[model samples]
Target: MSILANPLYRPLFEILRSARNGIVYGGKLRFSHALVINLLYKSGPLLPRMKSVFEATKDHAQVLASFAIIYKIAVHFLQSDAVLGRKNLRLTKFLAGCFGSWIVYSGHFNLFNGGITHQITLYCFSRVLLALGKILLDKYLVCFQPSFINYQGDTMLYKNLNGHQQRKLKNLIYNKSWKYFAIITWGLVMFVYDYKPQYLQSSLRHSMTYIYDVEMDTWDTWREFLGI
Candidate 1:
């Protein structure tokens, strides 16, 4: 029977589908990205610039498509039979992410001296960090309040804590976590951009400089004011 027809391998179809979609989507996105960057910074004949963009699209798209296929396969293959058909285990996901990334992204794309690969991986790293944070919030949450015990070794937390206080604290966290996270994220990026800009991607560093380092001189013209 086909892998899709078997219950044990129903996700094979999704893996294949992901691969196909990755090629198409990554190609389009990489092509646009390369083309835009070339238009902005490259000084060359149109034909040569288009040729360069095409070459970049090929390498970047290949890297993205390969990672998509490999990660999907790794996630499925690493699943244990005892917990099959459930959300992927964190340990399995960690192993699969590391191993698959090692296999598929071991080499860099040939765009801008492989800067495209750096950009992709850095973006993925940020996204994966946020995703894992969300997962931890959902599955591994803990109360920082110290547990009190009676003469016997039993947690008095439940007895001391009422449901309203529990709900209030949970509500406070749920409502305000994102606010603090956003502020801290911005602060960290600015800190890096200020003193350790070499740690940032070239495009990001350049963009930050444009935004933050440009002189606030008197406006010379209406065109300048209007950003024409």
Candidate 2:
């Protein structure tokens, strides 16, 4: 089922639809927020990876544009919540901001570290994006309504999470998921770093190889410098 078809997400969909209609008929300049939302809905899987491209291409303007769109969406969600008193709206705005910030940070970092293979940056950026999703789901269900999850033999949306299963799911989403993503990103970063020497040695004229070498070296040194 489409996310909007689910009762749990119907409210959010209504709000977004209303906002979309408002822009279409109310003559409001909502393109900024609309762009982000459009990309999110239409390119859900690729949304995170696209940020890497923006960064690698040094498209700061596009990155900022995307952020601006997300910012507008945040404001819209907040205002809607204030008017409609849907508590989830507040959390939704919080999620958007958190996700938006992480995306911007990841994109900017990837762009600045553009000396490496875009694939490496793409992988890291995707992890960051996925981390944001996990954070949203964790924060919403754990903090807002720990009892809203269902964990019996058959899974269904909007069911309450039992005590035993709650702890397990919470640990899985909040801790284990993040830990796994971090480890994978670390491995990829290290791989790029170790291969940098070989890649640059073969193609000295390849500026990106050099960039990768420098970026990876700097990251390694920083990690050791901080003893992390």
Name the top TM-score candidate: 1
Per-residue lDDT value at 174 in model 2? 70
**Candidate 2, residue 66: lDDT:** 48
TM-score of each: 0.62, 0.26
Off by over 4 Å in 1: 1-16, 40-44, 72-94, 106-114, 140-175, 216-220, 224-227
The superposed Cα distance between candidate 2 and the true structure at residue 141, in angstroms, equals 11
All predictions: root-mean-square deviation over Cα? Answer: 6.9, 17.4
Q: Which candidate has the highest lDDT of all?
A: 1
TM-score of 1: 0.62
lDDT of 1 by residue, 133-183 (tens): 665654543434545454576675533657775565446655587677789
Error of 1 at 107 (Å): 4.9
